[model samples]
Structure formats: structure tokens, C-alpha cells
Target: MHGPSPRRPPMRAGSLRDGMTSRRDRMNHVVLTGDRPTGPLHLGHYFGSLANRVRLQDTYEMYVLIADYQVITDRDLPGSIQRNITELLLDYLAVGIDPAKVIVFQHSAIPELNQLLLPFLSLVSVAELSRNPTVKDEIAHSSQQAVSGLMYTYPVHQAADILFCKGTLVPVGRDQLPHVEVTRLVARRFNERYGEVFPLPEAMMGEQPLLKGLDGGKMSKSRGNAIALSATEDETAALIRKARTDSERLITFDETNRPEVANLLTLAGLCLGRAPRDIADEIGYGGAAALKRLVTEAVNEFLRPIRKRRAEHTEGDVRRILAEGNERARERAVITLGEVRDAMGF
Candidate 1:
């Protein structure tokens, strides 16, 4: 029903290669990062990526995408997606991700960006897609008995998310490295088959890439082990109270044997900006209760300003930010799509 829109005359071969090189050089500083709007972000998100995003915005040209379409990749569409998007924006703002400095946009709003998936999907084989470890893990853990086609080619869709923005720096945890590798492969293959119309994005890992859940498993909103960024002080305390800590009275940061205890220390240390072992030493004979009390206090204190900022925002403010960001993202997507179309001689 739709076709490649009219674009400028294709660049000459030599000039096109030169243009690609120039664009790649400029794109080296562009950082693409985002989260799925399935639920409110939690402490794991804070230490894992949100904190790093706040720090990176000042140094790089950052684009924070709300991956709305990815919500249904492993499950049915959630009715809370609309509210979740607003909450995600609030979380981003509360954590000092200045919308003025960062382009925060929703995925479903940009048709041109999704349009990239068709071309990108063709560059990779089904076998290769099946071989992606992340995809395999997701499928293994998924509730659905049968995986959707969208879930299968998720890596390629991610490639579109990265390449559509000419994003060369992608912030991801170690587990997510494979998805970024797929993006790089698509970029390399596309360039080899057509022309260099994309920049191979590099994955940027944060200092603390993974944070454990309260239950000593992966901290996830769906798993009910994470404390949301918007959680009240009382709510945070209640959650931490239930956090799985061992019966060993003496507090020590031994991650191997005493992982649960170490996790509590890690959470407190992250909030206090100190070493977990130091925090453990400070709570020497006090044990889990004392450690829990300290973590609750430290976490609540650290989140006070962020909660205040979150409370200050209204739904109207969120809509305005999304509008401005969507406009900017669409502008970039249009230009990138046109270049891709021209390069493919469409």
C-alpha cells in the first residue's frame, strides 16, 4: 500500500562513500538508549542504566527512546502501556535526564523508524536470528507457548532502532550485548551489499551493569522484586523489609556465599556512593536488620529529590516533552530513511 517516497537524486558512488564516512565520524558521539514502557522503572534500572544515561547526556548527543512497540514482543499488549510511557518519562526527568539535552521519544510514533525494519530484516537470515542467545533466553523464559514472528526478529528491529538514528554508541548491559552485535552485523552487511548507509554501533556498559532483585534473582518489574523509582518512602521501606537476606547475624559483603546480603549492601552503597564492603563494615555486628535499616534510610534519602521532581510534573508536561521529542526524532528518521532509500536505488 505504501512505497518509497520521493527523495533527492542519489549521491555519486565516490561521494556516497565519502558521505557515509563523514556521517559515521559524526555519529560516533551519538548515544542511543531506551527502555520498554511495560512498567515503571525500578532500582535495578536506576543503577544499571538510568544513572549512566543521566551522566552520558552531558557528554554525548543522547536519544532516549521509549520502546513502546517492543512491549508485546513476548506477551500480549498491556493496557497500562499509555500510563507506563508517562511514568517512564517522569522517571527519566526525576533522575536528571534533561529533555532539553536528551531527545526522549516514543517508538510507535515514528513510522519511518519502523519502516526500516523491513529492509533490515532482509539482511539477516532466520537461522542467524534463531541463534541469538538473548532471543533464546527470552523465549525460554516467556509465558507464551509459541513465540511470535516479531519476537523472533527482535534483534533486527533493534538494529533499526540504532541505525535509524545513526547511533554509534549504544548503552547496554552485558546480557544485551548480543542485540547490539546484531545491529553491528546488519550495518556491516547492509554496507557490504548496498553501501555504507549505517554506522556500526558499539555497546557501552555501565560500571554496575546488572543489579540483583530483592529475591536474589534478576530485579524485574514483572517479577515483583524491584522497587519502582516512583515508590514512596514507606513503600520502599516495606519492599526492602521483605528483601531476601540470610540469617547470618554478622554483616559482610561476600557476594559469592552471601549474595543476598551483598545485594542489600550493594543497593545501599549505590545510593550512598560508597563501597558496599565499607557499608557492611560499618554495620558489623548489627546483621540484616541493621543493614536493611541503613539501606532503607539511604535509598529514601537519595530518592527524596527525585520523588519531589516526579511529583512536580503533570500529564500535560509529559505530553509536551513527548511531542517535542517525537518531532525531533521524526525529523532524523525522515532524513535517514531518505538516505537509505536512495542508497538502495529505490
Candidate 2:
């Protein structure tokens, strides 16, 4: 017989500060993650980092940054960036990230973070910056004929974002590993030169499944193939209906032979919390048309509540939330920057 139902762990009685020597001495790790406010977040972003952020918020001292400054590396439209920043804030709240638990702020609002970037630039060489594969890949895809200095040095700015908060953990995909590496390198170099001021941040790599666009390419707003989180239920249905699928009579999980059908199945599996093969097996006899219909319905159902919640918030509400978060973030950044300045004799 099964052993008596497993008992839950007993709760500790004393205050955390009483048990610990200092509030800072308590060893909870800080996590830093973010998105550039270039456009509205979508399902691709949700699976990539948003869902993971929700899971990790309670366990870690979470800092969610909206990289408004980083958005200018390619875009010059201030109005568009401003609009997207508000949208990103609403999206974060709609996805269940409690403001009380998570520190969400605009990247540009933290002036100290930008101040920390100055010294970090000197610690890293131009050659090393040029060697970052993520930067190189981005340059190749970017429409700009020549890369800007800001684009080349943005990784160092990212290092400041991590070190400014003494972040120990960063959640990122494989493609973003290079940026995190730069942050680690900058941290080590600064510590060696001055003193041990910043924690060496490590990558918390997750199984970030990249979702494809309806056109079977990478999901992107610029490409006009993405199904945005802000999309209405009818809009989501129409987008999925037009998604590319092969002429296969039976559903199968053959990425090589049936990528389009496989993509649809992957989407359904992610939304429904089942394996792609399991989804394929269930829909095996239904054919491609039936499979598409199933995916469309599932996606709409999943987004219904999220869309409704997003609609409830106004622009003014987002601004108020952001103003409060910026004040809180500045206080934390000030403490870290003070430590860094003292270490460097600034």
C-alpha cells in the first residue's frame, strides 16, 4: 500500500530577518529578464520568456525591464516606442505578474543604469564587442545599411542592466546566450580590476521552443506574420485559418517532411499542455483542414481571457503602475551603483 499521504514541509516560525544576520545577507537569488518595447508581445514571447517569468517570480527577486532605450538601436520612431511601452506594461499585468512581487520598470527610467554603462564600456574592448555573434546576426538581418555605434555597444549596456541590480540569474534563449556571456565577462573584469562589487550572473537556459509565424517563418511584427497577444478572438481565428499547412491527408509530427503541419501541432500542444506527437496522434485521422480548425479554436480559447483582461486597463493606469515601479527600481539601483562607485573610488 502507498505510504500515508506524503506530508507537506512545515513552515518556518521566525521572521526571515531575525533568523538571518541582515536583510541583504538572506540568500535569495535575483533574476533579470526583459523585452525591447519595439512592438506588442505575442504567443512567441509568451512561450519564450513570459510563462517562465510567471513561474519564477515567487521564487526569485524578479526584475522585469522594458528596454525602451534598446528599441532605438534600429527604430527612430519615438511615438511608436512610447505606445509600445504602455502596451508592454499592460501585457505584463494581463499575464499574471503581480506588481507587488516583481520589479517592472522602463530601462530608460533608470538613469543610474545608464551611468553604470560608462565604466563598463572601458572594461570591454571593441574587438570583443565585435565578436558577439548575436550582434553580428542582428546586423546581418537589420535593414540599416551600416550598423550604428549604439547597436555595437548595446551588449555592454546590457551588462550594466545586470550588474546594476547585482543579478545572479538571467533567463534567456540559446540565441541570447552571447549577450549574457558579455555580461558575465564584464562582471568578472570589473571585479578583478576594482573589487568584488557585482555578482557573476549565470544563464538559466530553459527549453525555449521558438514558435513560427503563420507564414511558416520566424514570428515577427515587422514581417507581419505574428499573432499578437493583443489580437481579438476573431483576428486570432482568421490568422490561424490562413496558416500554411501541407497537403498531407493525415496529421504527423514530421518536422522534415511536414513542417507546416508540425508547426500547427506544436502550437496546439503548447496551448493545450500536451506533446506534439500526442496532438498529432489525436488528430491523425482528421486531415490538415480539420487540424487547422482545431488549432484555431484552441488558440482563441486560450487568448479569450487574456484579451479581456488587457482591455480592462487604460493608458493612464499603465503610466501610474510604471511611475511607481520606476521609483522602486531607482532605489534599488541607487544602492548597487553606490557600492560600485565606492569600490572604484569614484
Candidate 3:
């Protein structure tokens, strides 16, 4: 004689070595993951990596890096880079990324990562870098324009990021497997040449690692198709209100054919913790309008507390957090660099 269960609320949901501990937990394997601070983090980022980071941080010695250096590879906006760095930090905190649990540090602050980059550069061949699928896809996406040498060699830099922190687990999308492969190659070459200073990093992909963009493309800020995590309720509603859907009056999840509607369904399902097909079935013959409205409401509900928490943090708070992270990152960098220099007889 019980009534139907009420709908549940949406689930609210790094760094690096500046917060390193002197404990003997170094024997425990560590995870290193990060994002380029090119723009605000979006829902795509949430499902793609942020969600996984939140879960993994509790179990692993997590190092979440704000890849400030990597941002300069494609663009030359120094001012935007600085501002995005802070924004990125705020986004991390807003999404329930506990700094105390994960050492969230900036990539550039650790000079050891850069030093490792140089030695790794010698290990990877230009042809090898060119053969990377991500590099080719990115370069092609950048309008086939002339890219900086750094842009071309970024996979090697990524390897430096992983090995510099001795990261063993790198959570990434399936498409990023090549980057992790190169990291493994670089680690093996270095270990074979000098000594086993780094562990071979492996790619960890979640069951659903990617979330499509509003425009039925890859969710990306550069493409202007992403819904940022810090977007206001109104902004989120507007974005979903504008999301593309098929002309079919009936709501259904057919990702291969009805990709756009399916994408919205996926977003709603993720926000509400249900399957996309379940949502599609619930909507039934209500058509795209009803589907959009439900998705908008679910997305806004999810973002409400996150936006509120984000508003509470000021620029000064972000700076203090980064500074502390930088210090901790430097501590580990110093130790790693000294060992590397010794091994290389530098």
C-alpha cells in the first residue's frame, strides 16, 4: 500500500605534488590527472573526468593539475590563461573537489615536469608524435593552421606530467589512448636507459567517458558548444532550450540515428542518475518540447548548489589555494629533480 517513490535530486558532484606528505604512502601507487585551463569546465568535463576524479581522490594519492603550460600550446592569450587558471580552480572547488584530499597543483609550478619534458623529447621521435591520433585530430580541428612546436610535442609534455609525478593511473577518454600509449613508451625508454624512476601509466576510461555537445559535436569551449559548470540556472535553461533535437514527435533514445535527442537524454539521465532509455520511455510521446523542459529542469537543479558554492569563493581564495598547492608541488618537484639529476649524472 505504498505510493510511488518521489524523484530524487540530482547528484552534486588535484593536483599535483605541492601537498605531498612525508608518510611512507609513496609505496602506494598514485594517480595523476588534469585539465587544460583554456576555459570554464563544463558538463562534458564533469562526466568525462571530473566525476571520476572526485571518486578516485578518496581512494588514491590523487594529483590533479591545472595545466597552465598546456594552454599556451595552441593560443597566445597570456591574460586569458591567467584568468582561466583562477576560474578553473573555482570550478574545481565548486564541483566538490576537496583540496585536502587531492593535491590539486598547477603544472608550470613544478619545474621538474619541464625538466622531464626535455629528456622525454629526446626519447620520442617526431614521426612518433606525428603518428598520434589526438595530435592529428587536434591539428586538423585547429583549421589545419600552422601550430607551435610545443603544440606538436604536447604528448611528450603529457608524458612529463605523468612521469614527473610518478603517476600510474591516468583516467582519460578512449580517444586519448594514444597519449597514454606515448607516456608508457616514454617511461619504458627512460627506465631502460637510466633507471626505473617512473611507473608505466595506463589509461582508465569510464563506462561513459564522453558527453556530446549541445550542437551534436564534441563538447568543447573552443567550439562554443559546451555548457559550463558555473553557468547560472537561467544560462543552463537557455542552453538546453537551444539544444538541438530531431523532428520526431516521440521522445526516444537512438544515439546512432537520433543523436541530438539522445545526447539530451544522456545529459538528463546523468543528472538524474537514471538510464537514458528510461528517461526516453518516461517522456513517451510527449515530444521534444517535453523532453527539453525535463532536461533543463534537471540540469538547473544539479547546477544550483554548485553555483551557490562557487559564488562564495573569491579570487583571493583561489590564489591562496593555488599558492599552497604550488608550495607542495615544489616540495615533491625538488625531491624528484634531485633524484633525476643524480641518475643522469647532471
TM-scores, each model vs. reference: 0.89, 0.87, 0.89
Please state the error at residue 193 of candidate 3 in Å: 1.6
lDDT by residue (241-344, candidate 3, tens digit) is 88989788889899889999999998898788788999999999999899999999888887777787888889998888888888887788788777777878
Clashing residue pairs in candidate 2 (N, C-alpha, C atoms within 3 angstroms): none
Full-model lDDT, candidate 1? 0.82
Model 3: lDDT of residue 303: 75
The residue ranges of model 1 lying beyond 4 angstroms of the native Cα positions read 1-28
**lDDT (0-100) at residue 89 of candidate 1?**
91
| Predictions in order: lDDT | 0.82, 0.78, 0.79
Clashing pairs in 1: none
For model 3, the run of ten residues with the poorest summed lDDT: 1-10
Give candidate 3 misplaced runs (Cα > 4 Å): 1-27, 143-145
Residue 336 of model 2: what lDDT? 85
**213-239 per-residue lDDT for model 2 (tens digits):** 889987776677888888987888888
List, in order, the clash count of every candidate structure.
Answer: 0, 0, 13
